[model samples]
Target: MKGKILELLKKNKGDFVSGQKISEELNVSRTAIWKYMNQLKDEGYEIESVSRKGYRLILTPDVLTYDEIKDLLKTKRIGRDILYFNSIDSTNSKAKQLASDGKGEGTVIISEEQTKGRGRLGRNWVSPKGKGVWMSIIIRPDIQPIDASKITQVTAAAVSKSILELGIKNYIKWPNDIIINNKKVCGILTEMSGELNKINYIVIGIGINVNLDENEIPNDIKDIATSLKIESGKKVSRKQLVANIFNNFEELYEELLNKNEITHSIEICKENSAVLGKEIRVIFRNKEIRGKAVDLTDEGELLIENQEGKIQKIISGEVSIRGVNGYV
Candidate 1:
């Protein structure tokens, strides 16, 4: 109801809208309209209510309040149910719990500050309070468990596209990352739950350093990670950024769900990837492979050419990337 009123006021920009007319249009009583108007006011919307004229909407805050993010998001379902937390251990953990409880699909957990955020390979992410975006998107795609890594590719495109839409120069690092000026701005991790043949749920975790101060960063990550605020000289609106990400994701993820084009999507991922043609040292559990990043196989495996001219394909495992600084 408040959203409809907002659209009406925004449509009439700078014009006064009467409460009676709004109520008639929305088929709600004048009291409900007044209540919703107060709700908008509490959400940092500048609305002027007068005796004669109904209400005049002024401005929208740039913060990541639920109300502010709801309208900006144009997705059909992915962001329709956003659970935001002021502080949490990990959105990924919460999203998993929600998925396990069968709350429903398309459930998303977003936090401006994650207290114990975990990154890929069990690393601790520098997700301080209100400094970055720590979000987990729960998806139950109709694909198998092994093919679930496709979500990483989907997120690569979504996150990279969102950053590009901001007009800042950046590129997608292969597998799961967005890098700018040779520093990591975003990291993605895709986890899944499934049986041998059937699939249950998947959680795609995304973390972006939106507007963190240099002082807030720990000494270890200061040199490798950078935020939009540090690069653009201003704090990027977390609400706007998160909305853009989900809005873009809705299009891509929906297409993937409809077609199940796992192979095609992985090919698209390789084309936009910056990991190829670089010298990288891959660290596995027991042995390591050092070779030139040659290409990705049809099954989303990394093909590395060793010094002996041997082509080794790695399908699944953690990759300790080295030799590429621009797109870490």
Candidate 2:
């Protein structure tokens, strides 16, 4: 009821919207509509009340309120059941516990600050209060465990598309890093819990450095990772960016769910990739393979061109990527 009323008010956009008309349209009593309007006012929605003209929505808070986000949502209900918190240890870790209690698919766990955030390769993710986006999605896709790499690729595609839609000239650096001007602005860490033969659930942790200033970044990482503010030369609203991501993610994920569209998605991913046909090196735990990044295959393996000019398909490991100049 609140969402419907809120939408009507927002659509009306501060013109006169009569309470009687809203009640008739929603088939509820005028008193109930008035109650809803008052409730919205209490929640920081600036609603002006006149004698008989009902109410007018004057302003909306910048916070990522459930109603505000849903109002802009045009996709399916992917982030419908959001578990938003002010602080947490990790969204992925929490989602795992939630899944154990039989939580349904598409349940999102988000936090304004993750005190003990993590990123790919167990690196500490810097999630300060109201500075970045720290969130995870709990999903239960009926797919084989061996095909799990596709999920990371799916996230990569969705992120790249979303970032580009924001009018940012960013592209992908394979496995999972959103690069802008050759610096990482976002990273993903995917974790799953289930048996090999039968799967249970998956949690994908996504962190985007949005509003951090250069001074906020640690000296060691100042040159490596960047935020939207640094790239765009001004502050970007976190609520707006997050809402766009969720909106695009819901539709793309549904397409993947219905048709298992990994093949086509992967093809598009390689096209926008930054490492293709370039000389590169993969540093694993034991050894480092220096070669040209010939191509990325359907199986999500990096085909490398060795110094001897031999083709080597290397499955992604707990390693690092580097351009011929230096570590990337």
The 0-to-1 C-alpha lDDT of every candidate, in the order given, reads: 0.79, 0.78
TM-score for candidate 1, residues paired by index: 0.82
Q: Give candidates' CA RMSD values in order.
A: 3.5, 3.6
Clashes of 2: 0
lDDT of 2 by residue, 1-328 (tens): 9889988888999698897889888887888888888888776689998978778989985555566566566766667788877789998889889988889887888888898899877789998877888899888988888767778887887877777767776767777788777778888888888897766998889998888898888888876788888998878777767777787677667767888766655775787787777667777667788877888787567788898989987766533356422566
Give the alpha carbon lDDT tens digit for every residue of 1-328 in model 1: 7778888988887778998889889898998988988877775679888888878878865445555688788888877887877678898989989988885677789886788898888888888877788999988888878777767877887887777677666666667878776678999988888888877888999999888888876778777788888887887778878888898888878877887664554655666666678777776677878878889775567789999999998765545456444424
Error of 2 at 158 (Å): 0.4
Error of 2 at 16 (Å): 9.6
Candidate 1 lowest-lDDT run of ten? 319-328
Model 2 deviation from the true structure expressed as Cα RMSD, one decimal place: 3.6
- Compared with the true structure, model 2 gives a TM-score of 0.82
